[model samples]
Target: MRPDFAASSNPDSITDSSTWEAELNLGFTQRGDKTVLVRREHRGPLTVQRPFYPEGEVCHVYLLHPPGGVVAGDHLTIVATVENDAQALITTPAAGKFYRSGGGEAQQTVNLKVAENASLEWLPQETIVYEGAQLNSSMNIDLAEHGRFIGWEILALGRPAAGEGFDSGAATLNWRISRIGRLVYMERLRLDAEAFQARWGLFGHSACGTLFVYPASSLHLAAVQELIGDEANRGVTLIEGLLICRGLDSRADLLKGFFERVWGLVRGDIVGKEVCAPRIWAT
Candidate 1:
């Protein structure tokens, strides 16, 4: 007689039923020459309220991922608002990891808005994609007149340790930046494991990342070009004061280190040291 497979259910199967969801909002306001803000929301499954204060001119925010992370059909949203003349920096406590989707898809959306003459630095930790996971992410930024903004995204396709490198699954990323309801920068990246892994495609290196700055001046453009020269075979584009840097590498740590170096250069030149780094990164 054949074994009755339906009679036995594994413990792992029972635990996979629970899904994860996280909704967070961070608000910043200017106080004299300093920017003060409070993080009022929950982190993943943990229901705790945390507040952050700026050490100098910069304020930091940190995000912690749930224990198991997003399952199929999970949705996560993050919204940030910077008041007039305020400056703030946002970062995640650690890199976000997306596990394989059991049956459905997972999505994440980020929205950022800056008031007139305000500045915002979006420096998320990083994102790692696991095998068989489907992820869709979008970033939208609205800038006020004379507002300064800088941000970066570093994505690793798969677990290099296990020799898994985006061999399957799908990912789509979109970015849009606007000024006073007028579009300034728009870009979209779509990739499939097999298609993108080809020699000439995106995943040939296993990891890719982008760094962008808005309202680039002539001097800034020259300086950025000089800084990126022969660093990693990067490409720089300028559109209406926006400077964009696109880079690809075979290692995840290399991409992260590159962002740190480039961010330091750009921040020192454009935003100065008075601004605070994201708090999550400090820990």
Candidate 2:
């Protein structure tokens, strides 16, 4: 039987709490030729679905938030560990929503560890920051020798299609990537409504996205160049062993699709497995 979300079956059970603190820890290991999710634990609204082996050897999991969104005073933390030679892919079923905060800030932190010869793909959907929402998000990845990671983060500020704009509130992002206990990539970003207006900042774009990959070899870099195609809003760069891609667009969905195309191409070349959209992504 497939494992499902562990949070309260009733989504409303978490909304009444003055402050929400949730944590999920997952561990994956390889058994013979197939990777499996061997450990899963949760403390609050955070949970994960059963592992799916669409690629035969790669384990796929969907992270879940029963409350459907993060409000003020909500803190969520996720920690995932992949054992040696194990391969895992993690994603979300839907876009994460950061609701308007009356006065407090919502926080989320993700920590991923990949053992030697292991691979991890972090491909959560876009994050929507509603008007007046204050949010802080951080992600840290630690890799051992020969470990690999590919992931992306997309943020949409305000609901432009609905006539709402990010007139107020603040959002901060921190990301750190390391291998063998040494830092390879790190970034810090602070975006407020006022900063969003500057041409040098988000470039007046309501939505921005970034994709990062580790162990980017010459062949992988060439593959990325071929994938660039006619994407004028996107740029790719290689730093150390990491390949960084960034894009800005008024439509978050369109931007995500563009990135997805690139992901398919590069992922196939580097991981030796063609990109297969998660079943949940289509639903």
* Top candidate, metric lDDT: 2
Error of 2 at 205 (Å): 1.8
* Worst 10-residue lDDT window, candidate 1: 3-12
Best model per TM-score = 2
Candidate 2 residue lDDT tens string, 1-283: 1112133342223332366799999999999989989999999988998888887999999999976788779899999999999989999999998877777899999999999989999999999988788899999999997998889999999888888888898899999999999999899998898777788777668889999988887676777677776867778888987899888999888888977887886776456689988888889
State every prediction's TM-score relative to the real structure. 0.86, 0.91
Q: How badly does each model clash, as a count of residue pairs?
A: 3, 0
RMSD in Å for all candidates: 5.9, 4.4
Among all windows of ten consecutive residues in candidate 2, which has the lowest summed lDDT?
Answer: 1-10
User: Stretches of candidate 1 above 4 Å error?
Assistant: 1-16, 38-55, 274-283
What would the per-residue lDDT of candidate 1 be over residues 31-110, giving only the tens digit for each residue?
A: 88678774455455432234366566676655555453555576788888898888787777777766676656788889
